[model samples]
Target chain A: MYLAQIHVTYKPSILDPQGVAIKDAMHRLDFDTVTDVTQGKYFEVTLSADSAADAEAEIEAICDRLLANPNMETYRYDVKELANQ
Target chain B: MYLAQIHVTYKPSILDPQGVAIKDAMHRLDFDTVTDVTQGKYFEVTLSADSAADAEAEIEAICDRLLANPNMETYRYDVKELANQ
Candidate 1:
């Protein structure tokens, strides 16, 4: 099987209130060295595909279609082969 | 400045409803090749630290204290130096 690690993040131009809140919380907690924070989604998908290329194609389609909003967010993924556990 | 990309994910034993929902949604959308999904948090932090080591230390502390639930989640991070843009 192939496992894909996907990261979907907001475009830099967008405003991220959750990130801002986290940054503020960090300041409140006394970690003022952190200047900014941008929050996003990370997904790990296990696919029943024969090859990494096949898994990549399926995952890219998924990301383009559902995992990320094309307008406000962008996504990237890495595919790795997994051995049965 | 240093930029830290942190990934916080649930332990393998934990249930991830969000991931399950996304998998179901993918099935509904006709992409059944995906067998399983796991979801987590991705954070891009811009820090005004003197060096990568310092940023890593601070981020590790932040992750331990506020960013993740130590009992339920495991976290990892990558730090990179960003050139002024």
Candidate 2:
């Protein structure tokens, strides 16, 4: 078994309203030190696989098909073996 | 400067459609070993801050305001010094 950590984020050129909102909130909260705020998603997946290579292929397919919005977002993943499971 | 790695994931009780869709895709791709696929998002931020404490507070504000869906998602972050920047 292995664990896959996936990340999905908006493309840099795209406007992130959520991030903008956060920045504005910070300004109001007296944290003037915050200049920019960008928001993204994170996932941890447990894969019941026999090998890392197989898990990688499966994870890539997952990203290409559903984990990311091809037009506005990009995805990446890291896979590590489960030491006890 | 420091780098903040943020992760956002759906609450376990909440249904994750994106994750389910990825699982189905994995099955179609002939990787029968993949039994479950949960999807999430990740972000790397470069913070121009004087210390890790300030960065932590800033990042927490980011999460409470925009990085997470308070009703359905959970968020976490790690901050590290940027050695070269």
Candidate 3:
């Protein structure tokens, strides 16, 4: 088995209103040291691939096709071999 | 400055329908090496804290108060001091 941890984040050019809202809320709650916040999606996927390379290929395809928007967002993933299948 | 990367995921006992749906989509896409999938929230927070320890403390508090629902989700974060600050 292999495990892939994927993070899909908005490109720096995108305006993230939700992140701004969260930062504003943090300030209201007096955590004023917070200077910036960016929100994104995280996914953990377990695969029954024969090798780590195959697992990574599958994950990359998955992210490109479904998890991330090529224009607005970018994604990266770390694939690791699981101790047990 | 400090940067904290926070991830909030559903507790093990919680049902993740979104994750199931994503996995189903993956199967339909013919990239069926995936055996399981879990989705979560990711946050990148920049703070002007005096030290990494302080930043970590603040992040923990932020997660507890706003980023995560204690009843259904659990959060973890990594905080490191920025060289430019």
Candidate 4:
């Protein structure tokens, strides 16, 4: 088994309104030090693949085709082996 | 400035229907190797703080009060100092 930890985040150019709202909320609650916030999605996936390289390739394909909206987001992932699961 | 990267995830005992849905979608799309999927929220918050330890403490407070549901979810964070921004 191999496990993939993926983070899908908005591109730098994108404006994140939800992040702005969170910052404002934080300030209202007196966390005045908060300056900025960026929100994103995290996924942990477990799969069986022939090799580490294969697992990474599969994860990339999954992100590109299903997990992320390529026009608005970019994703990065780490893949590692899991023994006998 | 200090940056805190946070991840909020469901407790292992909690059921993640969205994750199950995503895994099913993956399999239907022919990615049968997928065995499990776990989805969570990710955040990057930038704040002005006196020190990294203070920043981490603040981040933990924010997570406990706002970002996570104590009964269902748990959170972890990484804090680091950033060059003048």
Candidate 4, residue A25: lDDT = 90
The per-residue C-alpha lDDT of model 2 at residue B84 equals 70
Model 2, position A49: C-alpha lDDT score: 72
The candidate with the higher lDDT, 1 or 4, is: 4
Clashing pairs in 4: none
lDDT of each residue in B14-58, candidate 1, tens digit only:
888998999999999998888999999999998889888998999
Cα-based lDDT at residue B70, candidate 4: 96
- Expressed as tens digits, the lDDT of each residue in B1-85 for candidate 2 is 7778888888889998997886776677666676676666666656678789988988887778766789998987899987973
lDDT of 2 by residue, A1-85 (tens): 8888888889999999987886676678676766566777766677777689988987887778766799999887899998884
- TM-score list, all predictions: 0.93, 0.73, 0.97, 0.98
Which candidate leads the pack in DockQ?
4
Clashes of each: 0, 5, 0, 0
How does candidate 2 fare on TM-score? 0.73
Task: Sort the candidates on DockQ, descending order.
Answer: 4, 3, 1, 2
> What ranges in model 4 sit over 4 Å off?
none
lDDT (Cα) of model 2: 0.77
When summed lDDT is taken over every stretch of 10 residues in candidate 2 chain A, the lowest stretch is A29-38
True contacts kept of 4: 0.93
* Positional deviation of residue B34's Cα in model 2 after best superposition, in angstroms: 3.2
lDDT of 4 by residue, B29-85 (tens): 999999999999999999999998899999999998899999999999999999995
lDDT of 1 at B41: 99
TM-score comparison, 1 vs 2, better candidate: 1
